[model samples]
Target: MHVLTKVKQPFNFFTESVIDLDAVNFWLQKINPLWSSNKALGKIVQKDIAADDMVSVMIQINRNFKFGQAGQHHPVFVAVNGIRYERTYSLTRLNAQHVLLTVKKVNAGIVSTWFSEQAEVGQLVEFGLPYGEMTVPKTASPLVLLAAGSGITPMLSLIKEMSKTQQLKEQPVKLMYWVKNKSDAAFLARFENIASHYANFSFHVFYTQALPADARVNASHAALVTDLANSIVYACGPSGFTAAAEEHFAAAQNVQTEAFSMSALVNDDIGFVNVTLLQTNKVVSIPKGVPILAALEQQNIKPKHGCRMGICNKCACNKAEGATKNLVNGAQNTERGNLLKLCVSSAQTDLVIDL
Candidate 1:
């Protein structure tokens, strides 16, 4: 009898899934279960007076918040009675799990009030990831760090990191900290400790407002340049202060600068000029000397900005159509068909911008 052999059908494997390695890895990392735990959840630790008007709020974050490379800022979000506010502060301490931020309380800032008056230990706040492109280079060249007022925060981080890692031998690092007074100096003890410990590191504290009684030698840009001539210089401060410093270091080839506000663009009389927002088709007259960003802000329209001095590329907008005059250098630089920095450029004519 011929056995009815069941013809074994070959397995088709039609429903098998093929994974794209890159996509699989991306989703695995982005949507991983651990991601939820890594979100910024802040725990108020302690408060200490870093200076007369400046205070340090210690925050303990969960899930190992990524530490910045010496000189970077993290935006802290605070909520009080359901009102949320955010402000960016530079990390004063480097390579530490707990983040320390020093803030000078503004007269009427919401978050500043909460930090100065309401914040308590163990209270939970929110903090964004570390951001800012101002970072220390991994070079062995001589380094010059300059800062004013609270701008010294990031420079402190860089000095501390260099001291901790014994990296001073690789480069001669000098700090030129400019403050209004002795009491306005933030992280003085830490800076003194670094200066004392590292022979390669030098500290020069300049008091622009008033010199301290205990100050042996007053600090000046000329003094710093005399010591570390032709060295790579990094500076941060208010726009006016940075502008003055920048002028001093203009001859130095290796000078880099970061400013808190673009106040330099706000001159005496930046007369009004008409600007047309290309995307919105709205024509707004902006004062010539006043920054275009400020004009937008006055109209209740907030434009993205960082340094405001044409240094940081934050307030860059497409000049889809029209001409502009840059008053800073008295140069009639036009951008009829490209991106322009609204912080520095004023509308020369009825201008169109991709707002």
Candidate 2:
């Protein structure tokens, strides 16, 4: 294998002078599916149903896959019907060569449905670099984790890392997870084991559909732990749940959050701007002050996207021309040749972007 790699390196460099590297990779893949020169590829090693519609996949990655912080999300690329699609999911590292990806099947999610029902062991998948800021903090402050539905994915990753490092034993850690039903929760057994081993670590699962009905994240939820003003909180879930977490922990020392699904933007702007897709040579009139990704999708023009909250750069494209506004920070970009994350950017004027 070493000799073949040494020979292939110079051979590929020589062939790229005349042929595209992708073509070289296409031929090389016939010998070994993981033999990509640039792309990070992984093979599915195991699969299971974690929750009602959530699929858990253990992927054995190649050397090209760069391990990331525990709470980061990685962009996964898969093809369906010869059309490639990309989506981001939070990944939990099991070892240097393996990562766990848990995905929930959305009603009409194409890639998600494939993973849930069609993906098979030994199937190859492509991955991009990881991106996120919800990693565990270095502070020794009391830690609180709030998760809802699929938001538990990242929290699980974070908790695993903390347990490995014995952080769960060193400080007070509380995890409060919310799900529609008891069966909607994942990793209940693992949480129980952790709590049993570490008196400092505790977890609670809130079933919203219970007969008595459990309240969502609110001021009463704050009573789950003492020292609310000094605890560092990490919350992930749908938009409404994370928003409520922020409100509930407003008095906390710090609150970090990421929402898997975004809520509808409620901007007051009422105008349309023409967005030109240079690659497709098509034009779309999108509403001003609305996210470019959402606007384009409304016109049935779907571009690649992941973590629609702007943390993952999967939907980012080159802005050949025109100005755009950052929906998150209200910053404006008028410079040509700037890369913009479409999920969090709005067209401020007529724009040309590579799609």
Candidate 3:
């Protein structure tokens, strides 16, 4: 029994140097793209053009994929023209084995354009673990969800998750979706079907470009809520709309907002700072007020990144020295040997980074 137990102990393949995992994975992927020793892969099973500029893809995720709460985003890695680009997209789980990903084509967006024009049904893609703090709260407070344009993707997921429990009938849930026109709306029929079944759940579509234009979310809309102060509000949209929602809902019990894009901050510092990349031994002068990821990309140094909004930690790197300012909150940090998120941090001084 002791001899058998000794043989059952885990083998240290790296220290023993007995096998090349990369080489093995290469051949395994050739046989089956989803077959891997340890990787989260998914295959696109269906594709639908939800709108002229929006595409909905149904992906079949593998066993290695780690599932999370409904309102989180997952980093999807795809190779276009032999260059890997990573982007984070909100996902709606269809079942234990399938998920739906919606992509909206933005101006000069490579991945979104590819999905809108060239993505096929059988293509394979890699997915990182889902990450985000915006999710359905456990408390039974009345819920108010505000979504604009593509921001409706996560709201759809959160609503579906709520529908699975008895809470959908017990709690008051309302969704206010804003779009330029009714044609641009993605899941109008689905929301309608859900509202028909549950008396406590309802949704309203606001068209901003119609003959009788519906104004964006404002105090007038807040008056529609029965009890605004006690409701838990979740808002997702463009930066301007998200900022407005946060300001308008300040009196709510809880308010969570996620902006899809953020405008670059105009820094007060006019000079430049030298940033040293330890891995490549390359030094570049970057604008003092610009985020490190953007500054590095301007110098033709592309580091792996997902969700330029700083939600995903894919752009985080080790900072050996120097100070950084948080662009999101205007906080300054001079701590050494710390991890810095390049998407949300600007160099405050000359710095060394392990990239």
> Which candidate number maximizes TM-score?
3
In model 2, the runs with Cα more than 4 Å from the true position are 1-19, 264-284, 288-290, 297-306, 313-341, 344-355
Model 2, global lDDT = 0.88
Question: What tens digits encode model 3's per-residue C-alpha lDDT throughout 212-272?
Answer: 9999989888888889899999998876677778878778999998878764555687689
C-alpha lDDT (0 to 100) for residue 145 of candidate 2: 93
**How far is 17's C-alpha from truth in model 3 (Å)?**
10
Candidate 1 C-alpha lDDT tens digits along 1-355: 8888665433212112323544433443464422222346667688988887788888776663666677877766678889766566787662345878777776676776677778888787666667666677766777888788778888888877777788975678878887777788888777777777778888877776783333222234646465455677788877666667666766564767666554445445545767777667788777666567778989888778754556546789888776665644434656567778887776665667888
Model 3: which ten-residue window has the lowest total lDDT?
6-15
Residue 345 in model 3: shift from native, Å? 4.3
What's the ranking of the predictions by lDDT, best on top?
2, 3, 1
Regions of model 3 farther than 4 Å from truth: 1-18, 263-283, 300-304, 316-340, 345-355
* Prediction-by-prediction clash tally: 3, 0, 0
- C-alpha lDDT score of every prediction, in listed order: 0.69, 0.88, 0.87
The RMSD of every model to the true structure, in order and in angstroms, is 9.0, 5.2, 4.1
The candidate that wins on lDDT is 2
